[model samples]
Target: MLAAIAAVAALIVIGLIIGFVRGRKKQGLPQEPPPPPPEALREDRPKITVDAEPEPTQPLQLEDLVPRPPEAPAAEARVTPPPAPPADLGAFRSGLKSTRGNLISRLAGVFRPGRELDTSILDEVEEVLITADVGVHTAGRILEALRTQMNGGQLSSVDDAWGAIREEARNILASGGQGLAIDQTPTVILVVGVNGVGKTTTIGKLASRFDRQGKTLLLGAGDTFRAAAVTQLEVWGRRVGCEVVKGKDRADPGSVIFDAIEKAKDDGIDIVIADTAGRLHTKVPLMDELKKLGRTVEKALGRPADHVLLVLDATTGQNAIQQAQLFKDALPLSGIVLTKLDGTAKGGVILGIVDQHKVPIEFIGVGEKVEDLKPFSADAFLEALFESPDALDPSEEAATAS
Candidate 1:
């Protein structure tokens, strides 16, 4: 009887627990919510493009966005500028030819770069330029510049030596070239050289250059003595689509210059390039004429020949040095334009002229075509001089038609 009573008590307790659980569920209490886990979120992002092709809109690719390289500076040298034909190969034409020939020969001979430019080689270079008629002070300056580099333990290989010399020469030449700037209104470029130096040809070519620049110009036949000078300038002017102003062959050069200026002003022309007669050796009368021309133009144009570019024939060798000195002394010569390089052998004389006068070679005439004028680049020139004729700057030919 006692055992049966204990069993009944256990059953009652189990029933009471079951009833409590059912009542909570019915009351709408969240059925024992599950325990939460880890969490995260999501969105969109962009990317950079580098190199993409021109396919309309392929959603610019990353590879298509590289920056473009900058253009090279005008005189930035890859090698050498080509040789120019000698313009005023007057007295030393044969000698100039010889120098140019030697350059060709040396260039053919494995490009010695001049015996490693040892003290001996440098001295030889100095002597070569001096012998070619470069002035003493100018030669000394070049030598000293080289000497300084050597003393400073800078020059070693032939390339380095040449580079050092070239750098110094270029710097000096650059200095002289920079000061004589061109003008905007009635820009005047006075070209003066002794007779038969291709002055007229240069003028024609120069006029053509301005024509391309959209510069309205008038060519003044200041060269009255040469029988064909005025006509030649006229031919070039016609070819280039410009105007020419002339007086009788014996007319005063100063008066001719003034008249040209007056006409240019009246017509609103942009430039007046005067082609002065090829004044020959110590012609005091002609020199006076040039001086008078300068003064008269200053009065009329408000600017004397802004640029007096001296024309030298490379074939003239040492005489080129003398001519440079004469012209430089006679007029405030602005720069030099060398011609006849394509036909002559005395190209080294160019360096001598630079060494002597500190004049930057502004242009070089390489051929007979009107386009054959090129700007000078020291590095390219040196390379050509040291390298083969094949190494000559292509622009030398390119300028032949410009």
Candidate 2:
């Protein structure tokens, strides 16, 4: 009977617990708490942590989207300019030393302290100038000017005479003008000369000059008579980093030059330097051939060649004058390039060429270096020719002493 009473107590406890759970469900309590809000459930949602101080935000601006140029001062500070140096005339003096010795060294005895500055001394000066290969006309003109200066008591010594000569030389060169005209694009230059006047070498140096100016250049090996000339020009082209247009060993030079100009046009080259065969200037047929070549250049370029440069050897002295006369008569000579100046005492031939023909000396080959082939400078040449070896520079003094 006791066992039956314990079982009935256990059933009453179980029934009470079931009735409580059903009452809670009817009251709508959550089975596992309703899911948090979508924002809290999303793992990717940005989370903001509390901070002591927050940065202030500004609205987007159009200026901010555009690229900012560097500040002016900052930009300027970044660049270091190159130093500007003074012009050095030492090279001019050194190169003209031989000519100076030839001309001025003779004047040292003529204008000595014991001698009077008279017509006799002036005559002596003229003789020295003529002997140094200054043409007779130029020498006479110089003597006439010296006579005037002496009459006015303007010249008292060798120094005064030098000043007068320098002035005259300067005036003569200035009359011919200094610079080469290369204003047009693909300026075509026709280089012509008699045999062994450094025509090919001058062309090479000229090409080097244009190349250094950052201009594109093309060379025409029109000196086809001499295979060596064509080969020399090709070597220069390779050295200077330009193209050389050449024909066969004995091709007509005019056609070779004509094709070079055409090639220049097609390639848009900035400068075209054409070399013609080294013919004898005295030979009419050869000169006619040169003229024909010039015509060919004009035909190819659709205009006259920009420059017709006659290369002359300074060592030829007054013979160079004859060559210049003949060449100028044949071609519309634009300029003259006097080479071998450093090797000759006859550099005075320059004054003769300019005074007689009025043809400008565009370049002078002072030394063998490419840089030695310098643009004609009236002031520099006069300074070099006239200045006392001791006055302008110590290097000049040293050169003289040597």
Candidate 3:
């Protein structure tokens, strides 16, 4: 019994030692919990994708294209100017060579481009014109026109300003605005002027004009006092295919006119141009004889001298103006016929006559030939005065407004 008890005690002790070692090992084994579900593991972890998210963007601006502009006009950009005829484009008259000599001289002086005109020079121009037989009133107005042009920035040069004066004179002459009216009855042109003013020559030329116009023409040698008068009228009458009435070198002038006009009316003549004895302005009695002759024609024939053509010598200068004034006062002068224009340096007499007498220039005798008489034109007269018209003129003539 005692041996058995010792063996059992040894076994018990060994078993106890083994159990303690196992407990310690288990405590060191890191206390691992039981395994969780697979779904719970996926829910707790992070996720990844194949494509990543993009970042932010930006914007645009201005100074990006061309540099400058183009040169010429386009193909469709053409314009048209106006027509240029019947315009005051520098055409000259052949006849103004006579009746407008003084105007020519004055215009020449004004067109020479060197001198400058102030009030003093203007006053000199006035004095020169007035001395040349342009009346005081006309001279004053012309100078005033120049002064006004100077003040208005128009008449810049001395040479150019006279055109304005010339243009003004043209306006005055054109004031006698009646055109030559042809009547059914005979048109009688009675020639009157101071001696040496080309009266007889003008009568012949006038008769030629009428004859050339295909009219029946008649002439009267009314200046019977002059010894050569009858012969001269007969010469002109023959030259123009005209019939003439004359006296025995010293018959009453009135009786001769009466016979001529009566014969013209009887013969169905279209015009009768009568040559009167040239008289001085001082001869009032001789002029009264003309008035008495006028009365006789009025009584004998229905047509008196319908047109009293005053023949003037353009070279006569201021004397022409004086003559124009006297003749206009004495007779109902219809128009002026200027003669003896060749070789005249001073042509201002035309302006003076126009200014003083207020008469229109009807014809100009440029030469001794009958065909030398030319119809009066203000524009042509202007060009004659200026020589060349395109040289910076102020006379644009109210046209260029369009």
List, residue by residue over 1-402, the lDDT tens digit for candidate 1: 889998998899898888887888898554553332222111112333436533234444333464535654442312122333433333233323344345433323322545554576666666555553444666677778877888798877666765665566566555434433446567778888777777888887777666665678899988877758888887777676678889986888788888998998888889888998876747777677777777888898786677888888766766777888878877888889888776555566676677667777887777666567655655456545444345444433222110
Those runs of model 2 whose alpha carbons end farther than 4 Å from true positions after fitting are 1-88, 152-158, 389-402
TM, every model: 0.64, 0.74, 0.67
Give the residue spans of candidate 1 off by over 4 A.
1-101, 104-163, 176-182, 388-402
Q: Sorted on TM-score, highest at the top, how do the candidates line up?
A: 2, 3, 1
lDDT of 1 at 227: 57
Itemize residue pairs with steric clashes in candidate 2: none
Model 1: per-residue Cα lDDT at residue 258 = 87
Instruction: Count clashing pairs, candidate 3.
Output: 8
State which candidate, 2 or 3, has the greater lDDT: 2
Q: What's the CA RMSD for each of the models? A: 21.8, 18.9, 38.7
Q: How displaced is residue 268 in candidate 3, in Å?
A: 0.7
Arranged by lDDT with the best first, the candidates are: 2, 3, 1
Best by lDDT: 2
> Per-residue lDDT of 134-246 in model 2, one digit per residue for the tens?
89999998888888888898888766776787788777888755466677778999998899998888998888777766789999998898888888988788777789999
Best by TM-score, which number?
2
